[model samples]
Target: MVTWQNIDTVMLDMDGTLLDLHFDNHFWLEHVPLRFAEKNGLTLEQAKETLMKRYRKAEGTLDWYCVDYWTEQLGLDIEMLKQEVDHLIAVFPYVVDFLDAVRSKNKRIVLVTNAHGKALKIKMDRTRLGGHFDRLICSHDLGLPKEDLSFWGELQTIEPFSKQTTLFIDDSLPVLRSAHAYGIANLLAVIKPDSKAPAKDVGEFKAIQSFRQIIPA
Candidate 1:
């Protein structure tokens, strides 16, 4: 159980933590490939093979989350493509209640995400969860991805969180590790970021199946 008294800041991630990751997974893995195959006169398999190779090369970098980078690299209109399947964007179960619980406790709630500005705008508009956060920060503005240790210090400049009294939750182990290395006292992970996929093995960290499991007391 979390000791509510010690946690004054609740930092959260976007895609997999507050909202469903299935939309992003489908958009990148299936939707984008289908569009690429159709646009480039290649078979779907060929397109996927081509894109996946490029994606692997940029996986942990800021470029991996930049829509403009993907658009330029793939020669696709990523913003337009995201709209093509905006219907897939959705918030996870009990996320609103979880946010409300934080507000009720009067703790600072912030969203720190690596999602591109366009992508973040699209999801926030689609789900309308923007108002729940006290601050919404995108890594693009920081010039560093959360996987980098320096990102924590950069984030502190704007959000002013204390490592000892803040709780950071995310679906990515690398990001959690980044926070851990920065001396963040509380760290949590999500096991099933994409409801359609199997639970991930978040080694050496406490985890939850849903935000419901950690709703503020």
Candidate 2:
């Protein structure tokens, strides 16, 4: 059976890894652009197309997560808008038990996400996942997305863990590819993100439906 027998450090993604992704999906796919359109007196399609294009242009950069960047581009107070839907933040199924299992085995649990400080704080405040982590590392804090090789360098400089023994779990395929290029020993992909959807593509890591599937009994 798959297990992390000798792993010393476990890195987790906050959004879809430890928390439910429906909230983020709904916020980005439904709420934000609609509100932006309303505030700017634009049609929904016009606002979504424009903002999505801008975000697409910033896909691999830190600007993608910057609320200030969105505020300047979309002409809306992104923070306040986020607060409007903040109650949607939720922990994923069996995540707390998985985290508890890892900690019970004395593994170092680190939260490695590409979320912005303000956004991360909103989720943390609402979900309490912060209390479970040994360190909360964000791409915004590193000034680069985790998909950049330079980000791994910055992560090592700050956290100082051996790549051969570190384990990381995330939902983004691109970010997982970046981690593989950096030689992380173990990687996991949250495959069945929606229990209701059919199987699609698996990322650079081993795909699993549940976090508990990988934890040793």
Candidate 3:
């Protein structure tokens, strides 16, 4: 579905695109709510119910991905909480091979993530995948979420990529839609971001279950 010959820049998402999304899914849906419930003396169900409402409200916004915002809003040390589950962090299958293949082709590989700096550091420390990328960009650095079309414009000022020759891959459909609207020539979606969760239906955009499908042997 992609024309590799026409692509010069490969923009990748971290959490679900390169790394398994299970850690994040478990953290927010189970771990955080459990801690919140224990701290407030509420039942786990109550905590999840309350937190899910808040999460839905912030969906597609920078606040949804900001550790500091959640920490302050929830009155909990979000960074420390992530560290507690750091062992769960993992890269997806064949991701390393895909990176190697892309690099072998002399493509500019960049990580464009909405993950907060603290979370990014934790995952990088655990996976040691930082050395493979040309640049690491966090949405927090630009004060704009990838869901916002303007984020592409701001990103260009710093990274200077040609929209007609760049390929962007992300698990979040909203972010992919934003990138598409910004005129990114190629867009791919992750159908199975969270390994523990069921596959997703990414309408219109091409989707892949594993990076092996895109990388040559």
lDDT of each: 0.93, 0.82, 0.94
In candidate 3 the C-alpha lDDT for residue 171 amounts to 96
Question: For model 1, what is the alpha-carbon lDDT of residue 133?
Answer: 92
Q: Which prediction has more favorable lDDT, 1 or 2? A: 1
User: Where is model 2 more than 4 Å wrong at Cα?
Assistant: 194-200
Q: Looking at candidate 2, what is the lDDT of residue 126?
A: 87
Candidate 1's C-alpha runs over 4 A off are none
Ranking by TM-score: 1, 3, 2
TM-score of each: 0.98, 0.93, 0.98
User: In terms of TM-score, which candidate is stronger, 1 or 3?
Assistant: 1
Task: Put the candidates in lDDT order, highest first.
Answer: 3, 1, 2
lDDT of 2 by residue, 55-125 (tens): 78988788887888877877778888889998877787788888888899899999998888888999988
Distance (Å) between predicted and true CA of 189, model 1?
0.2
At residue 178, candidate 2 shows an lDDT of 88
Candidate 1 per-residue C-alpha lDDT over 1-217 given as tens digits, one digit per residue, 9 for 90 to 100: 5788999999999988888899999999999999999999999999999999999999999999999999999899999999999999989999999999989999999999999999999998899999999999999999999999999999889778889999989999999999999999999899999999999999889998888888877
Question: Model 3 over residues 57-145: C-alpha lDDT tens digits?
Answer: 99989999999999999989999999999999999989999999999999999999999999999999999999999999999999999
- Residue pairs clashing in model 3 are none
